[model samples]
Target: MNNSHLELLKKLADEFQPRTDVNTRATVEAESTDAFATLVDLARDMQNRLDQQQNRIRQLEQMVETDELTGLYNRRGFLRRVRETMARAARHPENGILVIADLDGFKLINDHHGHAAGDAILRHFGQNLRTHTRADDFVARFGGDEFAILLVGSIPEVAERRISDLEKATSRFPLIWQGAALPIRASFGFTVYNGKSDITQLLQQADDAMYANKHAKRPHSESSHNAA
Candidate 1:
């Protein structure tokens, strides 16, 4: 993770260096069967330590990137990957879509059902959504009840289909709690990324559009209510 850690690894690996003595007798003694066996055990121990440390490092990195509730990338992890995508897009021909989807009536879910139920639903949705996307796609919990998806190297039609598929996937089953089934709905906005702005700005644009789309839907309900 850092220069010091890397140096430690190198040091661990270099611990089994051959004994370099000018005396032929000393060299023969060092290379004896017993000495060889001891060196082998030391080498094995070093390898075991390296493996353990590497595994710990990987776990720490995952914790840094992952959202505790959903096991999806948090905003930090998402933006880190976004910067990579942006850099790639800058150098080559790129076709990508950024979709920001915010849960509708998420506050009601928390208020009515309690935070535990809300958390259960979020975890279920995250797992369900994982089944619907590709391996290379970037899926993240942006914050709160908002999720973001980056469809890399995809056309508008592909993006559109993916969105439709995702919506359908979520709607397929209501979130079941105890004996009750609760519906979950989300408002989504998607746009093609042209590398016109930085990663953060691009995300903001998608988010703005998502809210706009959400607001746009409110009028119909208002009109229906007003008519009644």
Candidate 2:
């Protein structure tokens, strides 16, 4: 809610409340520091305004970090948060897993159906991914049709399970847009954090693994997407 609205409500509450047989003006005069009290009130008012400005600034920052399309973190937010998470995971006993995912036949989906339909699928898939992953896990859209999920304090099996669940989810629910049932196909490759000094190298490793898996399975359907 807006700060102005909050202030208005507070004003109404103060007016409605019943007060005892004590007068604010008489109290101020008895204190013999009316000027000082006024200064304190001014300072408090300034502080409230400052607090409101700070809250607005924080909201704006969150908007910057979020992806407008899918409500996931954009690449910048992903890198910023995941870097810290990975650093902590490196020191902790349990390691982390990074999965690089790309949608197969996404271009075709965009080409056949309008971009609106394409966006709908992406939003649905992104929300589903958010629901499926653990709360501590970080999910982000790495631009275009690519996404990344960082499973903090997790193992290879957790990443593997996510891939399997993703495949099963898409298969189970055929996305329907404009009276046409469309398949949400994707490919995923996972790389475990091995106490590497650089996190980008781990990302590169996952990307390479994804392509290798994609190429190896391309023969079956040429465009068949795999969650393997």
User: What TM-score, over all chains together, does every model reach?
Assistant: 0.77, 0.77
* Predictions in order: lDDT: 0.83, 0.81
Across residues 1-228, which tens digit of lDDT does each residue of candidate 1 receive? Answer: 999999999998778655454476676876796788999999999999999999999899889999999999998898888888888888886869998988777777888899999998888888767778889989899888889888888878988888888888888868998788988777788878865556667777888888887777676545432211
For model 2, where is the 10-residue window of minimal lDDT?
219-228
- lDDT (Cα, tens digit) per residue for candidate 2, span 47-103: 999999999998998899889999998998899887787667567745788888887
Residue pair clashes in candidate 2: none
**True-structure RMSD for candidate 1:** 16.5
**Candidate RMSDs in order:** 16.5, 16.3
Off by over 4 Å in 1: 1-30, 33-37, 194-197, 220-228
Kindly give the stretch of ten consecutive residues in candidate 1 with the minimal lDDT sum.
219-228
Candidate 2, position 9, lDDT: 100
Model 1: colliding residue pairs: none
